[model samples]
Structures are given as C-alpha cells and as structure tokens.
Target: MPAVVVTNHGGDVPDFEGKITIYVIICVFIAAFGGLMFGYDIGISGGVTSMDDFLKKFFMNVYEKKKHVHENNYCKYNDALLQLFTSSLYIAALLASFVASRLCTKMGRKPTMQIASIFFMVGVGLQAGGINIVMIVCGRIMLGIGVGFANQAVPLFLSELAPAKMRGALNICFQLFITIGILAAGIINYFTSKVHPHGWRISLGLAIVPAVILLIGSFAICETPTSLIERKNLDEGKATLKKIRGTEDVIPEFESIVAASEMARQVKNPFSKLMKPSSRPPLIIAILLQVFQQFTGINAIMFYAPVLFQTVGFGSNASLLSTVITGLVNVFSTLVSIYTVDWAGRRILLLEACVQMFLTQTVVGLILLIDLKTTGSLNHVEAVIVVVLVCIFVMGFAWSWGPLGWLIPSETFPLETRTAGFAFAVSSNMLFTFIIAQAFLSMLCHMRAGIFFFFAAWILVMGLFTLFFVPETKGVPIDSMVEKVWKQHWFWKRYMVDADDEEIKEQVHPHVK
Candidate 1:
C-alpha cells in the first residue's frame, strides 16, 4: 500500500497524488487564455495609443502635441481622454470582480470564464468599429468587466485542479500565457502600425483572438472537482476527480475534499467568515500583494511602454520595436518563474526581485534625472541604456511579483472562502491597476524621471513585507493551508485560535475519547 501521508491538520491534510495527465495539461492551457486576453489588451492599448493614425482619430490634441518640437518630453501624451482609453477597463474590472466572486462560488469557474470571453469579444467589436471616443471607452469598460471575471476565476481554478507538488508550475501558466499575450500584442502592434489609416483598427480588432479561444476552451473543459463537490454534486465531482487525477483509486483524496466541503457548508457567508481572526492573514496578504504589485510601477512602464520609449529619444518605429523587446523579456522571465517557483519557494524569488527591481529603477531614474530633461531627449547611447535598464526591471517583476501576486493568494485561502477571498484579490489588483493606469501618465508628466524612485521605494517596502510576514508555501496541500501555513507562521500564528483548529482536527481526524 502507498504511504498514507498526513499534514499538521491530520487526515484532511493528506496530499492528493496525481500524474501530470494530458487532460489536466489541456485544461490548464485553456483556462490560461484569460490571462492571454488580459495581456493582449494591456499591450495593445499602449502600442495603439502611440500610433499616429490612432491618435489622429481618437486623440487629436495629443497627436498634435507630439508634433510640436517644443513639447515637454515628459508631458506629450498626458491627455485625460488618452489615459481614459487605457485605464477605463480597470475601473470596470474592479466592479465586475465582486460580481465575478459570486459567479465563481455560485455558478462555477468554467461558466465565469465563458461569460468573460463573451463580454471581451463584444468589447473588441466595439473598439474596432468605434465611430467616436464614447464607443471606444464603452468597449474598454466591457473589456474591463471581462478582465475582472477572468482574473478572479482562472487562478483559483488552476490551483484547485493542480496537485500540491505541481501546483505552482501549473498555476504559473496563467501568468505565462499573460506574458505571451503581451508579446503577441507587441508583435501585432509592430506590423500593424505600418498599415496606415486603419492599422490601429486592426490592432484593436485582434483582441478578439484570445477571447474567442477562451470562449471555445470554456466549452471544452470540465468544472473543477472541488467546485462541483462544494456545490453538492458528489457523483459528478468524484468522476471529475478521477479524470483529473488520472486514477480510479482516489478514495483518500475524495474523502478529504468531501470533508472540507462539509466544513465549508457550515459557513453560510464566506465574506463574513473572512472577517474572523483566522482569515485575516490571507486577506491582508492578498490585498497588500496586489497593492505592492501595482506600486512597483510595472504597469506605468508597461501601459506606456511605446510612449515612454519615445519620450526618451526613440523614433516611432524604434519605440514600438523597443516595447516588443521588453515584452519578449517579460515573457521569458515569467518562464524563469515557472521553472524556479516550485523549487526556490515564493519568498526567495520575491525578495531577490525586490533588490534587483529597486536598484534598476533607482539607476534608471537617476540616469534620466541627470542626462534627459523636460525639454530634450536622451542621447542615442543613453536612450539604449534606458531601454536595457527597463528590460532588467521588467525581468525582475515578471519572475516574482507578476506571477506570485496571483499564485500566492489563490493558494493561501481555504476552500471555504477560496473564491470569495480571491475575488478581493482580483479586485484589489484591478483597483490599483486602475489607479496606476489612470494616473500614471499625469504622474509622469509632473514627476518626470522622479517616478522611478517612487517605485524603487515601494520595492523596498515589498522586500521588508515579504521578509517579515510572508511564509514559505512551497509544496503545502490546499486543504491544510491554514494549519500548515498560517498556524505555523511566526506572526500569523498568533491570530490562529488553537481551539478552532482543534475542532476542525476532531472533525477530519476523529479519535475515541
């Protein structure tokens, strides 16, 4: 007989074993289309906004400002409406995430992703066919809602389906696909920028590709076994668990899930339960990760990559090309995370990235502060150096904050509050992303090169936060996270009530009095 492994939480903590079955692989890849769709919009908007034709059609004032030889290098593209085009999606995403949380717990992750795709495709149609700014912004709002739904569901879905041993790697696929989508958009933006009057339209229309893929994939994949079991579909959940685990002998795993679901049933309102002392650690960490992740100023750089490149001295074509290079770096660095996350543990990567990102951002800021000014651009060599520095910063973020921001929160919450808690995570990310996206250009206009220092300081805080508060969760099983992780952490442990834990232990692993 196989060894019956147990955890700090006893019988409910047994790690479910599973092969890396083809079915699971396909499902992971499909669900990750949500990330692809999100990244596409992020990359596309930046490049599209920089296009002359695009600006002429939708933002003529910014386009005219770009032509003036005397325009402040830092302030050329800081129009409110131009910023709105990129940022409106995130505010909409923020509102949608709460609704998405309801769908994730009540309707299922599979259906939530399907709904996301439908809305995203419609958004794509509107932006591509936009006759005026109103149509485009409305489309962006639609896209935001789609993003909110997808971001909320996909990470939780991946974590639930994956085995503990391989969870990090599988879950990182969502971020991997996101990086790939950004790279794809960068490439699309490059060629289409040459297509004249309607090139921007082509760029905007192609957002439909990833959305369509997600819509189709949603139909193909099954609802997660955990979701099904939680909803009281025991037989179907059992069948899915067998399929996903690639085994008929799943008795221990099924019992563990059923027991957890039984406990989940006792908590009628998951959000209210999140307020209890036991739930505070994950909730606090989840929101702060999203906040720090945004404050890293990664999106400010990403959302205006082409515009930023131009501000430093690159011509239009060269700026788009530079954005593509950074996109490549982002995608490849995320792969580094995929390989190392399960091995290095979360804290190591995150802490190491903090130092790297801090130094790079600081140096970049200092360089621009000294060499470039509000009136003129960087010298060609200096401009190249800035691009290289930005690439390093992107690399640091991609491998650490980018993926872990999603991965950690998804894994930390117990099944009882998983979707609801993750919704807060999703909305937190969207809320700050909206703030950064909306205000970044204006901040850039005022802060000039000092903006980089602002982010570097935040990176320092991120490192300190991770060093003291974040616990390593390299291979912990999902069901026993509170006991093995939160209950063991030096700080979080204080908030954990042993009596409540004892009660749960008694239920999952009963003993004769």
Candidate 2:
C-alpha cells in the first residue's frame, strides 16, 4: 500500500504561528489583486454603459432620453443594449476560464498571471478607445480572457499558499478585495458621472493601470510550492516552501508533498480521470456548488445594482449611492466571515447566511408586490427596508458563497485533480453567471416585480441543498482529507448521523508533526 501522507495537518492555529510572514502576506495580497481587477472590471461596466448621453455623442442615440432621466423610468431600447455590454464579458469569461485553467496548469501560476495581465491591459485599453459598441464587446471579450485566467489562478494560488490555520481568512481576502473594488468603482462612477459625459471611458480606462501593476507584481510572487513538487523539482520546492513559511522544519512538511504527488501521478490527467465512474460524487459536488453559487442571484444584484435601485424608485445619483452602500456591506461582512470561518465552521456559516438571505429576499419580494399592487411609490419606510434587505443579502453572500465557493474546491481535491476540478467548477460558474447576468435586465424588464420571486425560489432550493449536501470542512487539513474522503462515507451524511464521532473528527483532522 502507498504511504498515508498528511498535508496541512498541524494542530489548531498554533502550527501556522510563525508562518504568517509579512512577505507571504504580500504575496497573498498580490495574487488577490486580480480579485480587485475582477471586481473593478465587472462593477464599472454597469454604471459606465449607462453613460448614454456621452455614448450618444459617439454613436447614434439608441434611446430617446439621456441616461439620467427617461420617460417610462427605463432607458428604452438602449437599456437592453447597455445591459448586453455589461454582461457579454461574463460570456467571454465562461469560455476563457476553461482555456485559462488548462494553460495555467501547464505554464505555472505566476507566468499565467503575467500573461493574463497583458491581455487585461490590451483589452481594457481597446474598450476605452473603441468607437462602436461591437469594438467594445470585442475588448470585453479580451478582458474576460485575462479576468478568467486570473480568477482561476489567483484564489487557487492564495488558498494553497496560505498556512492552514490562517488559510480561510487569508484566502477570503480575495473576496473582500473584490467587494472593495466594486465599492470603489461605484464611488468613482458616482463622482465622475456628472463631471464628463464620457465618464464611463475613465472608469473603463482605469482598469488598465491595475493590470499594469499586476504585470509588474507577478514577477515578485513565488510560484506555488505544490506546483514545484509536482514538476519533480523537490529541492527548489523545499526552498520555496521555506521562503514562504520562513521555517527550517520544512523537511517533515516535504515528505507529505512527495507522497501526495505520487498519488497524484497515479491519477495524472485530471480531465480524463474525472470522466471515470469514481469521480462522480466529487464532480457533481464541484459542478453543483458552482451552479448554485451563481444561481443565488448575487451577480444579478452586483451587475445591475444601480438599475435595480432605479427600478425601486431611487434617483440616478441615489441609485449609484445605494450601490456603494451595497458594496460596503459586502466588503465588511466578508471580513466577518474571515474571522469566523475557522471558529464556526464552513457548513454552519453557509447555512446561517443562506437562511438570512432567504428571509430577506422573501420580504423584498413581498414588498415589491405590495408596491406594484397599490400603484404606490416606495415610501421612505419601504425604501429603507429594500436597502436593508439588499445589504442583508450582500452580507449573506459575502460570508458564505462568495469566498467559500472559491476556497472549498481548492481544499477538496487532491493536487492532480484540483486544477481540472477547479477549472470545471469555475467554467460552470461563469457559464451560469453569463446566463443570469445577460438575461437579468431582460428578465427584470419583462418580469418586473416577479424577478424577486424567481430568485427567492432559487435561493430556497439552494439552502435546502446546503442543509443536506454541503460538507463541513472547517479546520480539516487538505492532504488527509483527500484520503479520508475516499475511505469514509460522504462527510455530510456521516456528520448528519454521528456529529460527535471521534474517529471522523480525527480522520478529518489527523495530527501533524
């Protein structure tokens, strides 16, 4: 039998004590800068495309009214057009993540990010200067390729590098930065929208500056030590791990990786192995989590926050201001998750967040229905409630799905299969994000108040799925968990039957040297 290898299996929090070096933190932060770019790119487009008055000067006025005010409180035909512009990037991301995953696996993480940054810089530059809508779409497609690559590579790099104890918290920094970027974009658009009719150009153009920064920053980051070992460069891999952890006792740690890599080699082509029968459960779980994460309607809110606020009767600036608040709430609450993840455990936190979201979403739907029925504008009370519920939903998402969805898949699979599994999961996520994101404006335009109910139903289903299916993976080390997952029954089922079982706990968390 192959030796039983344990990875990341040190005792609670203490094992990571000295490993949290400032240099390591800097590396994590840099890898997570891609999240900033992801947020900036996605969030800026929503408000930027609404620069209809400015865009009209360059192209034909697709709508009769300026973006500020319209006859029926909608932008007419151009509303759909602007939404398409914002969402097409997601469609491009859907395709690009698959390509990125394969390429990153071969090229190594840092180089992959460097290549991605080049795409982002070139793409966003083209977007800002594009004369026609089609040109902008092409630029977004290019931007999506870069974003897709970074989105796949960054969180995986950060999660794998983060010490086990601080892993969840550190990895979640990506999600927090994502919200910060969103809030920053919202604030930037709010202030700049009135300054120039072509304000969206500034917002779109700003992304390139960060892309340039990322291109430079990528060189300083150490490639993931795990990848080094997989390439059979053990000595350098040991040195890299020591540099990352700043520790001398890396040889004990090195043994686990060697055994794990050997197991990985046995399962070598991840895509091919996933096609076999044994991979079904993990594959299903991976795909389902990705789908559910997107279907929860988070993207709908983030992608069209200003419009959603407008639909609820807020003024243009007020709608944008509300978006800022939404972003702030998302950022802060994700911090709460960062602190609590190791303490409360993944499954519990996710369950609570989902329930809170379910209640809040249902209430929002009912309020919208009542307003539509009464022909009444949302009074101060209703508006406040709507804003609060939106914040609540943002909080729930930031804590649970936003980061955890990215973090968990990185932890769940063995090294050989991880990239492929994560690639598929991300691709599935982008696919759904594309579908929901592109159709959201059209759905809201056609369905009006009923869209909330549609999302409510989806959120409800997701909560039940979590209650029954999603496993609790708090404090579990990555290496042993892989072996235990193969030997033990599914974690959720085992936990459900015997929550206090000692053996399960030990297997989930074996002692590390």
Candidate 3:
C-alpha cells in the first residue's frame, strides 16, 4: 500500500513510491544530458587546440602561410585564436537565451529542449567534420545557441516538476552532469592527445552521443504542470501534476498553480514590473549571483587548467592528468550540495563557500608570486601545494555557486515573469562567461600571478554581497513572488507593510511550513 502524505493547505497526496521516483530521476537525468554536452563542448577545445597536430593543421596553417612565423610565434598566435574560438560560443549563447525566453513560453519546455538538442547535434556534426576555420566557427555558434536554450529550460523544467521537498536536489542535476561531462572530456582528451591528427576530431565528435540521447529522451517526459496551466490547458495540467507527483489528490497543488498564474497575468509588463521597488530585490539577487558565479573564474580554471598547469612547470602529460583530477573533484564535491542544499539552506552554503574560495584563490596567488620572486619556477613541494589549492577551490565552487547559480533564479521569480526573469539571469551568466573566457589567456599573459589575485578580490566582494543582500529561500513555494515571500525582510518591510495586511497574513501562514 502507498503511504499518504498531507500538504499544509489541507490536502492529501500519495507518498512517492520507489518506482515513480526512479522514473522522475530518469527524466531529470535525460534533460541533464544537455549539461554534459555543454561541458564537452567547453572542455574539448582546451585539449584540441593544445594539440600540435590540430594547431598546425587549422590555426598555424593560415598564420605561418601569411607571416612565415617561427614555431614558437605560431604557438602564441594559435593560443590567441583559440580564445576567440572558445568565446564565440558564449557570444551566441547570450543571444540565444533572449530568444529562448520567448520561445519557451510559446512552445513549452519539452519542445524547447528538443529544439536545443537538435541544434547541438547539428553543431557537433559540423565541428567534427569541419575542413576549415570558418566551418568550425559556425559550428561553435550553433552549439552555443543550443547551450543557451538548455541553460534556461533545464533548471526551470526540473524546478516545476520536482516535489517541493526534493526540488533543490533535483534541480542540481544540471550542475552535477556538467561536472560529469567535464570529467568525461578530460579523460577522453588525455587519451586522444596521444593520438595523431584524428585525436582532436574524436574528442569533439563524441559529444554527438549524448546529444542524440537527449533529443530522443525529450519526447518521453510530460510537459511541466505550470507551463500547461499557463497555456490554459487546466485539465492536462492536472493530469501532468498527478503523473509527476504520483498522487490522485493534486487539487491543492493545481489550485495553487492557477492562482499564481492569475496573479502573473494581472501584470501588464513583466520587465517594467520587475523594476518596480517591490520586485527589485529578487531580480537584483538573481542577476548578481550569476555575475559573481562567472567572476569566480571557475570557467577560466576549467577551460585552461592544462595550460595553467604547464605554465607552473608541469609537462603536457602531467598537466592533462592534473586537469582530470580537477574534474573528478568537481563532480564529487557537487554531491555534497545535492545532499545538503535543503537542509543547510542556500544562504549559509553560499557564504561559507565564498569564504573558502577566497582563501584558496589567495593562497594560490601567493604561491605563484613567491615562486616568481625566488626560484623563478615551482619546486616539487610548491607545485603540489598549487595543485591542492586548485582542487580545493574547485570543490568550494562545486558545492555552492555552480549549482545555486541555476537554482536561485529558477525559484526567485513569479510564474508570469519567470520566463523573462530566468532568461535575463542566464543571459547575464553567458555574457560574463564570454568576457572571462575571451580575456583569460590575455590576462594570464599580461598579469601572470596577478590574475589569481584579481579573482580572490572578486570572491571577497561576492562574499560580502551574499552576507548582506541574499535572503534565505530554503523552502519557499516556487510560485510565490519575491515581494510576498520576503515581505518580512528589511528591504520589503517598509514598502509592503500597509499594502495588504490581511492578504499577507493569509499568504504567509500557509507556506510557513
């Protein structure tokens, strides 16, 4: 017999059975395959560009022909072009996210994800078989567009479908798979780097496997209940709610969705409404979190770990191995957040992780600075310390911003403005990511040890921001607007105090649990 569970709103539901939980987990995992594609696309280029064969064939061919440069100069020119190539995807992603915001609302989440997967597959096909630089750049843009769509859709889809109790953990599937994808790419790069001209091709083409799986799997999942309700298909929404919840009594949840949708419909302009004083806190928090996540320099670390390791006196094989270790630490540490996010809450974890990252980044910078001042290169012990600090820094990020960056924005906005809100947040993320990716190698060239110091300072500022501004949203209902949810906080108390005491009392009481 299935156990019965009750909601705070005086409604009963069937406790989820093991089989139903498995089904939901499978669906979430499939959607998260997009994260794997994102990771592979990101991780592949670092290793491929580093390959002598790949550079000589694709980049050095043009430069050497025009300028007749030496091998060393050719390598330097190749590195610069690689950075542009890497960042081009993110540039495309920024534009795609804006389009995705409208398309997701118009087409529904499932269909939107399918479209992204198709783009991913097409992009991978072109990249894997490309004969020229122009073809490769075009492919990267397509993949970026796919990534932009997945970035917005996957988290929102999971948040809407997950049970309230499991929402945080379920949504984090996106970040977890991203780490997994990175790890897989790192391992592939390690082996493929030993091969000749074809190794880079194999590393890139492998992304197609996951893209195909995601494209097919997208069709099997039900449309989100909230999206269905928003479309005025109330009956189908109720059915999806029941299917996802594995319970017959979905009226309480269904009515809550209807009410939230009605409230959202009342707003005339979402972008304008988001700017009003009442809604500004959540919007600001969402955007700043994304900005800080990229500024942490995590992507720079992940995408160029091999190069950074080489700069610090490691050989090519050692650098590649070290990168794989970073990927493993990233994947395992994220499980900590998955287990504890609901229990530990978002605010504290983010704060503590930021502090840890700040310390690690500072230590890494100091070590490099000392090496430059004294030995002119790292000794074995100093090299070990640098490796340890990098691993710890990645761990801190994995357990905090990497997952929370996606989770908070998806949960922060009201139903009506959610599409636009999340789109803006995700696009903000891509914009910063593009800046960091494009500028990182240049910073390394110009600043050297100073680059780490820059990141450490940013981490400190992010920590302060988290301490003062970010509100606790541990178990808040997804449909509740920020104004309603954070009315008791200092920012909203003055504005909301006299607006609707009776309604506030009723709204606040039921979600108190």
Ranking by lDDT: 1, 3, 2
Clashes of 3: 0
Best by TM-score: 1
lDDT of 3 at 158: 89
* Sort by TM-score, top down from the best: 1, 3, 2
* Selected candidate, larger TM-score, 2 vs 3: 3
Q: Mind giving the per-residue lDDT tens digits that candidate 3 earns over 168-274? A: 88899899999999999889999998988688889889989888989999878788889999888899999888877777877777888898878766665777767
Q: Write model 1 residue lDDT over 188-278, tens digit each, in one string.
A: 9999999999999999999999999999877889899989999999999999988988877778888878988998887789999898788
Question: What does candidate 1 score on TM?
Answer: 0.95
Candidate 3 matches the true fold with a TM-score of 0.90
Query: Which candidate, 1 or 2, has the higher TM-score?
Result: 1
User: In model 2, where is the ten-residue run with the lowest total lDDT?
Assistant: 1-10
Worst 10 residues of 3 by lDDT: 10-19
The true-versus-predicted C-alpha distance at residue 179 of model 3, in Å, is 0.6
What lDDT, from 0 to 1, does candidate 1 have?
A: 0.91
Error of 2 at 148 (Å): 0.9
- Candidates in order have lDDT scores of 0.91, 0.74, 0.80
Superposed on all Cα atoms, model 1 deviates from the true structure by an RMSD in Å of: 3.5
